[model samples]
Target chain A: MPSRAIQENFRFLVLEVTKQIESTVQVVTTGDEALIDSVYLKDDYIDNLRGFIDAKCLTVIRDADEGDERTVELARAVDIVTNNLERMADFAVNILRQYKYVKDHAILRGYGLEPLFAEVLGALGKVSEAIFKADVNEALEICRSEFNLDEMYAERFHRVMSELRAGGEQVEDLVTTLFIVRYLERMGDSLLNIGEAIISLALHERLKIHQYWALEETLDVGRGEAKGLSLESIFETRSGCRIGRVRDHREGAEGNLVLFKEGQRDKLLEERAGILFWQERFPDLVPKILSWHEGEHHASLLLEYLSGQTFQQILLEGTSDELRAALQALGTTLRAIWEATRVDEPVQPGFLGQIAKRLRDVKKVHPGFGDDDQTIGALRVPAFADLLRRAEAIEAELPAPFSTFIHGDFNVDNIIFDPAQDRLHFIDLHRSRRFDYVQDVSVFMVSNFRLPVLETTIRRRLSAVILAVYRFVQTFAQEAGDTTFEARLTLGMVRSFTTSTRFVLDPSFARAMYLRARYLLERLLAHEGGDWSTFSMPTNVLRY
Target chain B: MASDNHEFRHESLEDRTSIAKYLNALSEAFANGNLTFGHNGHAIELEPRGLLKFDVKATRKRGAVKVSIRLNWQEDEEDRDPSVGSLVISTSGEGK
Candidate 1:
């Protein structure tokens, strides 16, 4: 038996311990993607949280020095909380173990947005600084002005994605850009959150308290248009060089910015080397490559320095219909790539092409192969015999077309809309490939309408938009005597035919893609005078 | 870590729920000589000390209890010596 007051104190301590545990866990959970994924890091965070809980519990017990019986009861309560808190830590650690990156460095040479990313990070840093300093006007100005860099980057990104889609470059580059852009966007969101939190805290009149300022901003500028370096030849330095004090202007932009790492310099040099190679192969790709000296490395082609609002930066500022316009611009930009693209290299016995080959082999081995769960599960639609059959049938009707570069990565944020010129500029063309039109279509569709949150109707409308743009682009390619576009389109159509049900039935992104496919097919049928519905795709294809 | 010389006694006071009325009754009883100290050989007072210790020792007994306690004391040098205390009882049944 214990006194009522001692019992009440014991219960109050238990509740406080619980509250502290909850708050600490919340703090530990909030962070970047890497922090959220790893079991080891998550476990460490949980353990740290539990340790705090233990300290709080100990404090409660020590402060409440009641008689022996009451002290004993409180001590027991502390032990109970300690045990349960430890268990919660274990659960958090288990969550992080699933996402591990295997590669030391994946090639990202193709998505050439070094300049754009540099500006993005710079703008983000300035905004964060303004928010930290409580300069609301500066914060708003940075938010408004950050989109100006989009024009340069978006065009570069589009060109790169186009090249990759056309199978002109490696798929590895495309994968890297996907991760890079996703992270960059997320980083932008984090900065916004920090700014909002600061504003909220200030409104409570608790401003300028508990400031621990240590935020890092990094950007890498690669190759041409930014060559030559000297502390003194400062004005001679180019846009890609690190911003710093001016020294001289005799030598071209080379080895100048002392702030930049040697690795960054090497990367820029690599880009220069790559540009030389590109110029040698495709002389007309850039208008008359300029040469400071008569060497391949010395040649420079000056592209228009783009400084306009990006669709993302614009959307962030909340001007309505801007995002849709940006999306449409992205779609149009991809359509342009689809119109002029072809595979520069043969499908080099790679995984995707191999799968297509295997589909052919498997069909030969088992002519009566039925779509059993095992068979369906093992099959990729593009590699299926039926899809290849449709592609072969469609290919015979189109003339052989030359392959032009296509951008493999096409997303809205990579587009820069210049209202003055009424033109959209694309950026990051490192992953420029010479592949089929379908590759471009897939990239565009996945990037544009692959959102997890889109409703069915909107998804359908978006699908329609994609197919319409795809067909329009393919037709243009056809008119230009580029039959590869038609071939690519045929392959894509065959794929759609074989896996229409699977596309439609996907529990996840299916409904969206299905609607888009339906819209595209309907338009395609109307124009081509052949009903895709009458083609009779089997129901077994809906294995997904 | 309080002053070791402070004296404390474990008194077997009556379990009183009604303090005022019961105290008054006890006072009247004491005045009327109905209650007496150590009545019917009952011990009500005890001596207390810091770090209370208890031990048992066996000794030869004559036709009764089989064991007896060997009590010892250690007092602070500046303090008065502590009073030694113990309780002794014999089994009711005779040892064969």
Candidate 2:
């Protein structure tokens, strides 16, 4: 069979690379120039073997049975594996060459070099399982090996640079050692590429190596004591946090699923604080934080995975009754939380400032959309920057009449709905805070409107949801005598719609949103120093 | 997801003679499973086939009258990349 042929050739290629690595390590450590012959001798064999494997890959893919998905995936994976392995073998040769330049061959031994070799070799050992068995945990270990190798290289590199800077007689040795460490770091990078390729093939989706490592480490630290765990990448946020859902297959841990999130330290800490705030106020409304961990400059959290579908899912695929139920549940939760945590103090959210922070990203996507001040016969329109400046000033003067603890993101996806329990749960609490409730209300409306599905039916559902949330919140505002709610909501919408265009590339759709944002800015600019309560938000702008 | 999108749009008033000619051309293009629209020195090509969603809405409010027509269909992505943006929309199931 083509598969058997490909596997056998691949096995031979791997063996050749392994031998090359082993021989290189042996010569570098023993300080024996004669041993370098074997390393050089094997280089030709490794290169030829890689070429052979590459040729076989083309053959199998071209001649295999049609629609043989397994063969196709395996072939593609082998293609990636051999390419990285060849580069790694080349790096090993590069190291052997650099080793000869050092005045003292023994000098390489002084800088924790053995363990770094071990880490690289150890990663190669797992390459088999990563490719053949398609073991995710094995792939995770392989990827983490690079991070470990980097730490080792960093320490040695610092000493080498420092010694060279000191202008010592051992400069040759230190500089050569510097070149050698760089090769080791390159080997680690190849290992990462090989591991991620296997993982992408195994999962039928591309998974980044660091993201895989993050998920594994979070599981290891938090509720990861349970064995036989499987991970699936769910979503990643613009904030660069890797989000995944994990299922525990350990005995008695069946159906135990949790979400693992890892990102910059401050972001995760903020999320932890948000969760704690909700837990104290209404525990059931937010996902319970299972565990939290921080190291270096990053943090990870294991959150109890609510089985409920997100509100976005309900709008797309749920029955009418289910949609209504979720909407009703969400409304009730918002009302109760607002009433319970309402603080009678004025608070300015800097919604326009928030837009300014992301304006660069928006410009990155829609470069020509940013406008300069323009004039008609009887009118002058301010530039986007000038409008934002005015809006910021206006926002400072017209703070929300009251403050309440609110979902900082308030996206449709962050809110989960459990049909079985008829409960609503929130996730990604990093942005949760005591802000103007209008911020949450406006975010929810725009999130619904921004969903890319544009079939008429879903659009109607989105419009209905936005309207329902608007009327519901408007009633709450009127009851609380929050007369400035409309004025603030328009500004909030301006922030969301303007910034959200970055995520969408549909030109017509993006322009619609950008134009609406500009129109709102104009309207807001036109109403300067007016009675804030008299300012009414044109709700149709929130409609799809 | 990395988005590579093309767009075509135009806004102008037209007489029935021009409107009829433009729409007749559009109908022919749609029937041929290929449509290209141009505006302001830019053009976009679209492929429409199989079942399509058609929508129309109209309103006559104040001193203005408006009408909108929308067409929707799925693109054929036989070799769609599994990894795009982080967002994945899927129905709830047993497990991955």
Pick the lDDT winner: 2
Enumerate residue pairs that collide in model 2: A271-A430, B1-B85
C-alpha lDDT of candidate 2 relative to the true structure: 0.80
Give the per-residue lDDT of model 2 (tens digit) for A1-544.
3467668878777777887888788878877677687778888888887888888888888887897867777888898999899999999889999987877766778875789889988999888767898776677678878889899889888888888888968988888888989999999999889988888776665777656556667666332232376665567787888777877786767768888888898888898998998897687888888777787898888898888899989989998888888888877778777888889999997888889899999989988767667764377856787878877777887788889988888899899999999888898887888889888888898999999988966777787788778887877888899988888988999999999899989998998788778778778878998998899887656655
Q: How big an interface RMSD has model 1?
A: 49.6
Q: Which tens-of-lDDT digit does each residue in A1-544 have in candidate 1?
A: 2234433443443343333333323322332444343435445554554565456556656666566544434344334434443453333333222112313223343344345445444544453234334443344333333344445545656765776788844555455455444443433343334343433222222111111010001111231112122222112233342222221222554422332111134433443454354345444332222221112222122222344566545544424354345445545544444444444443321212333544444334343322321232366333233333333433344433344455433444445676555456554343445544455454544444443434533443444444445544544554565534433453343334323323223343443333333333333333343433234222111111
Name the best candidate (by TM-score): 2
In CAPRI terms, model 1 is classed as: incorrect
Where's the lowest-lDDT run of ten residues in candidate 1 chain B?
Answer: B84-93
Tens-digit lDDT track of model 2 for B1-96: 113486566678898688988789889999897888777776677777434545567789996988788887655332243332121112222111
Clashes of 2: 2
Candidate 1 lDDT: 0.38
Point out where model 2 deviates above 4 Å: A19-42, A58-73, A88-130, A135-213, A221-227, A349-398, A452-454, A494-511, A514-536, A540-544, B1-96
